[model samples]
Target: MTDIAPASPRHQKNMYMRQNKVLKDKVESLELEVLHYKEQIDKLTLGDVPQIVKNWMNEYSLPWEIFWCFEHEKWIAELDNLFPYHMENCRCDKCES
Candidate 1:
């Protein structure tokens, strides 16, 4: 007859600590990924951006947001040869040249 022993309190606490640390590490990794993506998005130009995205940009109220959408169609080929040249422009108040 073999007897199984339950985990000790210290062993349980160590397991719990290990799990918590893994979750925290995952969260930190995700945060770093988000920061990297934000940096890339910051470098993106309005030119060649899709009309669907441009529409949202025009609708946005923030000036910088609108500027980021400025020079719309500058990357014309990005339209995949589907969208018209005049699909959308920065119509925001701050869009004036």
Candidate 2:
């Protein structure tokens, strides 16, 4: 096999610069794609309550649960308003009304 001459430093640097540019561009594009997917996930979860919050709600009783609902009312409504199934057997004065 014939030996090839090494590339000149200027040519090597130019090639390296081009490769660096390509890698940078690829990274930027991937970052944008990640941001896009994150936005999509956020949109899909916009009105969703986290499972941890659900579990926390399940761990409490009437007034405390109502307090939790009131405290988080900015992101959620009263517990009964959102989860009528659990409220079906509730005897709170607010629910009785």
Candidate 3:
């Protein structure tokens, strides 16, 4: 094995810049992916089967009873997260209507 010399200051700065650019690019790509997912989630309406949930059910191929129980639990958790802290005081027109 050969010993390597440390990078010079200019070389180190160049390496750092390349790394920063790569990281920034990766973050931008991930942000776009999250936005895509959010758009897909937003398209869901009442009684609609979300693609992910449908895939999960098809992949597992669970009995209807088991699937519904798990589905209900998942909905409960989602509902808990979706509600505002002051549910009764929500100002949205949809909530009022």
Flag clash pairs in model 1: 47-74, 47-75, 48-75
Candidate 2, residues 1-97: lDDT per residue as tens digits? 9999999999999999999999999999999999976765575367575565565457753222333233223322234543544654433334434
Candidate 3 Cα deviation (angstroms), residue 82: 37
Residue 97 displacement (Å), model 3: 37
Model 2, residue pairs in steric clash: none
lDDT of all the models against the reference? Answer: 0.55, 0.57, 0.50
Backbone clashes in candidate 1 total 3
RMSD to the true structure for each prediction, in A, is: 10.0, 12.6, 15.7
- Candidate 3 deviant stretches above 4 angstroms: 1-3, 50-97
Q: State residue 77's C-alpha deviation in candidate 3, in Å.
A: 27
lDDT of candidate 2 at residue 16, scale 0 to 100: 99
Cα-based lDDT at residue 13, candidate 2 = 100
User: After superposing candidate 2, which stretches have Cα over 4 Å from the reference?
Assistant: 49-97
TM-score of each: 0.44, 0.47, 0.47
